[model samples]
Target: MKFSLYVVAVPLALLGTVVPASASFAAGPAGADGGAGGTAPPVLRLTDGPADKAAVAVTRPSPDGSVATVPVGDARLTARGPSGGLVLAPARSPAGNGPGDLAQVHAGDVVAGPTTQDTPHGVLVKVAAVHANGDGSIAVDTVPATLADALGDAEVDATVPLTPGDLKAKPLTSGGKVTAGAGPQGRGVRLNVDVPVPDGVEPTEGHASALSASLDLSPEFLFSYERAHWYGVQPSRARIGMAADYQYGVKVHAKSSASYATGHKPLRIPAAEVNVDKTVWLGPVPIVLSLKVDYFYDVSADGTIAVDAEEHTDGRLEIGARYDAGEGWSALSGPEPVSTATPALITGSATAKGGVGSHAQVGLYGSVGVAADAEPYLKATATAQNTPQGASASWGLYAGLKVNGSFFARLDIFGTRVLDKDWELPPLRYEHKLAGSDV
Candidate 1:
């Protein structure tokens, strides 16, 4: 007698909305100068040199809107026309000191002492008033002191309001050094400073922290086996039989968003897919099978202290068998159970002071010639500790899969078993991790 079987299994369709990538916010621009005369207003420069070399000389703005002071030690102040330049010399006497102090100038101001060539015609330094705007912008009223006749005949006084569109920012260096400089442009001044937020994050008055997170789908796991069995010791009575295969893995569609001092936005990840298919011949019976798994996940971080995650899974399997001859083939089994909904195997959250994780396992069994098991897991953790004199915060997320299974077949003649065997496949595993830190 000759027989054949064919099977086809379809898994459930994946679900859930994917969050869009974060939007990038440009740094505010330097405010326009409100002075007349078409003369380019004098700008402040870190006479010390490039930001990397003069980092220590430049101070950063605080959350309280305090001024970031920059020393004017021998810094040169060049204006547009001839005799429109002056050197920022230190005050020689207490009476010669500007409103603020000696050599030191606030973030948005330019200060200088009496000129070396002419004490009476030396430049006077006027401090600037810095304000933090509600819409993530900084405004500065750069009151350039009345220029001495030796430098310029005009009084360069103006209230320049710098907006987020007015300032330009550069990437932070390894040492957290920010580039700082200011220059005059068409009766206006341009100020460049370092604000340590990621490209996509916007920093408002109260919020100024950076955050990033992600989720990924790993490769699938599959196993297959084949063996032959003989019927009788006769030449024409000889027969070959027994072949099997097994496979299982999930495709993950996930989205993540974060809320911190900086800001919040949704980030999306492409879906990952894992599919398995195999064919086996049991004597004159031929069997074909396939399986698929799909799932969705969402992760969010609230402030700098806590994180949460949630997930759902829709799994499916299909098996079909048929008999094939030289002329045609006959169907032995049709696709019935189209899909299966599997509960989330693992879920959990973590905090800045500790870490948490979860794990879950599932099994699949079939009579034709296939059986297997799968384990999926997720873990989240955050660490905060003192390092000698400083403290640091670190967070991470980990996920992966592990699978193992077997394939077998048996035959009997006249109530006597003639052939029986099984093949065991080794376990397979895959894992991924994402991490970030702040000090």
Candidate 2:
């Protein structure tokens, strides 16, 4: 199997254009013109055998065997007749130059399908030169709908024939030899053994052969032939091993940057990601669920020592079930996000997320609950910590449209409102692409 990853940094300015079901109709056509303001119609030219002519008023082909011609513009053509009627040819298109060029012309360009639903009568698409193989039949690449309509129905089928018979068959032979001593149930004893001729019986030189034993000899040699090196201590302790991984990435938005204007440099809070997954599955089901913790450091723009905060994360906890739907699949879920803070000095919020899925894909996920740390700690310090701070909860919805090459993107928008107030926040935006991968 092969894997690919890429990062697509779409400018926020252009997000509205491709955001799902969110674009406005007022953008209009990339480019369109008013009816009379549009460019004039293209010129039309026609020709017939042994004579070429130009005319504006032209007669288009009709379903019935009848003919009609009229003037369209200043030019005119001396009307000539074929065995059937004057077969006005199709127009040429830009992709190529030939009779077909016009035969498929639609909107001043060569097309393979009908460009318009309607056409006037007496219009005939011009055909290439007619060639007859001395025998009188002409070579043709395509047939007109009128001719095909007249021919009616034609039947086609594969020439190969099918043979019928019963598909089931018996095996060449019934069950053969079964190993008697194998696996955990058998103590690994060999059911068959090879024997070597006694040392003195090798005098005949005509034919010599050898047979080999299947089991290793080093450990068993002393226990069977020597028997003198036996001891009592068989290691009694079994070593156990464990492993884990955890992944976390979060974005924090600032309420406003205008408050802290002059002294400090603009703060850059790049997304924080922490991944920890722990597993201790020595044999079977009911493996111990692992817990992972993450932390983020956030600071207020104002140079206030009181607001430089740290997010002590309560890592996700996940437990996998034994049964599953397919290979590389598992039914598992994670614990919610929890934070550590003291009520006396800090006020913070936390969230929990968990779902069951396999690999890097999430089949189902949802929020379990929200919690805060240091609520009592904040109440005690409220008199001294006067930062005029507020907090509220908000969520966003997202839907992915299509995959483009290696980039997978989705459109999502969020709204925030101050609790118990009319203040509404502009929708928050987010987009992410797979950034990298390892072998």
lDDT for residue 95 in candidate 1, whole number 0-100:
31
Write down the lDDT that model 2 would get. 0.17
Candidate 2 worst ten-residue window by lDDT: 217-226
Q: In angstroms, what RMSD does candidate 1 have relative to the true structure?
A: 36.7
lDDT of each: 0.24, 0.17
lDDT of 2 by residue, 383-433 (tens): 122345853322221111111111011100000111322211122121221
Counting clashing residue pairs in each candidate, in order, gives 28, 35
> How well does each candidate superpose onto the true structure, as a TM-score?
0.22, 0.14
Candidate number of the best lDDT: 1
